[model samples]
Target: MQTQLNKHDMSSIKATIPHYTDVFNLTNTSRPSETDFRADIKETMVKYVTFLRKNDAPFFLSMFPIHYVNNNSLDFDFAFMDNRSSHKVNDGNATYTNAFEFLYDSCHWALAKANATSVKIVIGAIGWPTDSYPGANVANAERFYKTFLPFIASGKGTPMRPNQTINVFLNNLSDENRLFLDLGSFQRHWGIYKFNGEPKYRIDFSGKGRDLYPSTAKGVIFMPNRWCVFNGNLDDPGKVEYMKSLACSESDCSSLDLGGSCENLTYVEKVSYAFNRYFQTKGQASQTSDDKCHMGGLGKVVPNDPSNGKCEFPVEILSAENVIEGATFGASGSSRDRVHGRMSLSAGLLALTVLWMIL
Candidate 1:
């Protein structure tokens, strides 16, 4: 790939090989020097490092401190870069106060063992999610980035590599509703922005300790404010359950799971959430007597918002197909065409731009 890119005058775009943090040790990640890479992984890394050096490429490493808290029962405070954490790891003269540095140096030690100490390392993906778990909330996400961004900008590097430049790319941009849930529901909620182009919380990308909301997408077209909600009727309990199951199976219902944002909602609210999700996903158009919102006479469309505290029943956005069709056929060469042309430009700008910060 490097050779082909070089031939095409694209040699400036370096090849980056991404790997998980677990490639360092099989048993534990906290102790760096006390562990060695698995035989198969070590062989692969040796070959990869050789190729990377030949092509002047960089090694991209993905680290997630949230996974340690969720999967390994690590201290919650230790995941953040704040120094007030009670949990600390003593490795020789270096005391590790945060999981980020612990994992970075762990990978550094593995690279040294592989004789790839000269190769550059880039953080390909690292960020906290805002939902789908108890620890995964807006406050925690804000707290994590508040300290982590400054630490990255500080250029303190790790115990193994001091004062070295670190390039990092945030894990994602927007929440993904249709993501696979095998790794955990949190995987779909790892976005700083909501799926509808709204900022989830305040974040200072400059790493200067500023508290302000990020820029939001402008000119986003949304569907009608009407929401499909469950009527106060419990005559047919079995049918309600079946309807909710069908709706959730066809749409996203991960937010209703334990520790999710909507976990505290009432049973009726949960059913309504599922039903509304399905209705919005199916497009809010009414066809004859049968509508998507008609859930066995238990569902109805309402103009009022059904959001309860933090649990939001979101309105779907206008489909891209409609936008393009209107732009292409509404006016051949008039103000309508110009207006839709700008809308198309805005839509193109809405394309995902991954945040990459170098420190």
Candidate 2:
């Protein structure tokens, strides 16, 4: 039960849910508690509750605040915490302890307000990153989940709230590089699977056995096998540094930043990493400009995978045209023939359409 007010009407939202007792207003704001922000939120809450009341919806509405709780009363349902402990905590015990502690505190406060244990709890988000920055690697993520899944399944709640059933949703399903740019680059890396719907590692959601493979998305198309690399024979070696910086700025260089998997790369390798990322991300379209491939004469297109050691130079995948058409995952393929096949099919379709128009 979470959605944008602008995106979905109340009726549309209700239609999707059979019966829900909780609704969350998790709208993100920079200065979350500013006067105007509070006023707008209060108005929305009033209207939302009023609508629910008219329909006899019998629901508890939760309003998420930035730092501190606002207007604490039984009228409000509960608070929200976008708990991303894996951003810093690498130790499994610490992460589990912190997550439950956060939930316990929220539960305690909500119960105190209602003066009873009738008030319930919900964990808005809990997840780990699969790449970018220190502690964001797949191994650490797998470690965290291995410890976390079992703890929740045990039904042993935190010290403050024992044996309480709290609803928990993992932070994300797959990597979306487009969202949360204001947060660090790691924001997009917080997926159980990589961007193209491939699993990073084995995970057991059931707590039965660590045998679950990631579900891959269907109909995923990939760019060609070609990669852009730094020119080895550049007249001006100084230009190489400039091109490296420029390429990183225009594309994702989080993999080359501090604590990244590629943090130990040589000067030339760093530039190549950035150049290849940009090339792969742009779909490797047939009509792509030569200038895009040329980093001031310091870039070159190569037909080889540049992934070295633990440093992976990723090739982007083309998602289905619409977001809603997307789903959760399982295959990977990239060849010149496959890419050419795609291009040929597209061109043939276009030609057919043109002939039909002429006729």
Candidate 3:
């Protein structure tokens, strides 16, 4: 079972006789390679290296080393790195035309500094976003996936590492809203599916070169189909503007931003979009005493779909009562933490039931 350890737990595990690290240790996630190696990082590396040398156990150390111009080996058994060529599409003449070539060069560069005779490589994350940025769109995302998926499925590897089978892990399966702290808005939209379990576009995951729609998540229940809209007249837009700003501050406004899906909306529509997002994000059912949807009497709840062409005003899922299907294994946090979250939820439900019985 995978459990994300804290700093203290990590130290304890390292000090323990039998090191309880995974078979493949993916050290870095989105760290820039240009930064100087910190003392703590060097210390951790020394400990891991000593452990590896002392034991004949089969363990692999993978890291994301991007700016390794010098051929200094990291001495890891395996290397995991990301190749985001789509982000460099608008670099004018320096645009990356071929993602495969870029990935090949990156892998080769990392291999040169590996210091090991044979270091396996895993293409950690590589995908394109369809929203939340100027250049981000469905066409570009589709183009990237169509080309990259087939290339990896073909098992052609790279120019330098030809005939070798490279394991490729797609960036994400669905869009996430809460990951904005660690990732950009464009990063949230990197999934093949939208936030509501709906397929964004057709993708052939089987790698047969045929485009097919992926299966949507099952048993997902959502809150009521009501939306908070701008009740005040458009002439007096000051209050509406304030409400929009407040709503955006409290909830996700990425989908209604400058290059977002709702960017082309009118002033009224944009304000309503922001209001509805805030309403939904605050748990459409109202989880707390202060979780109110009223936007200073300027917002009204209506049972209408505010979704425009290519833009969807989402009604978030009621996930608290449901057993989240695929929330088991993730890179977010530990299983213990996840279990505790579920337990707290279960306890809340039990208390509510007991209160109802008493009444």
RMSD of each: 5.8, 11.9, 12.4
TM-score of each: 0.85, 0.60, 0.61
Lowest summed lDDT across 10 adjacent residues in model 2 is found at 29-38
- lDDT per residue, candidate 3, 274-348, as tens digits? 888888777564434654567877777788777788677776555554344533322232211111111124233
RMSD of 3: 12.4
lDDT string, candidate 1, 274-357, tens digits: 988888777665465659988888889998878787787866665677776673222223211111111123333453432321
* Candidate 2: tens digits of C-alpha lDDT, residues 165-260: 555667556555556555456666666755444456777777544756645433445544577888776577778778777776666777676667
Clashing pairs in 1: none
Worst 10 residues of 3 by lDDT: 334-343
Q: CA lDDT of 237 in candidate 1?
A: 94
Off by over 4 Å in 3: 1-97, 114-117, 181-183, 233-239, 286-291, 322-359
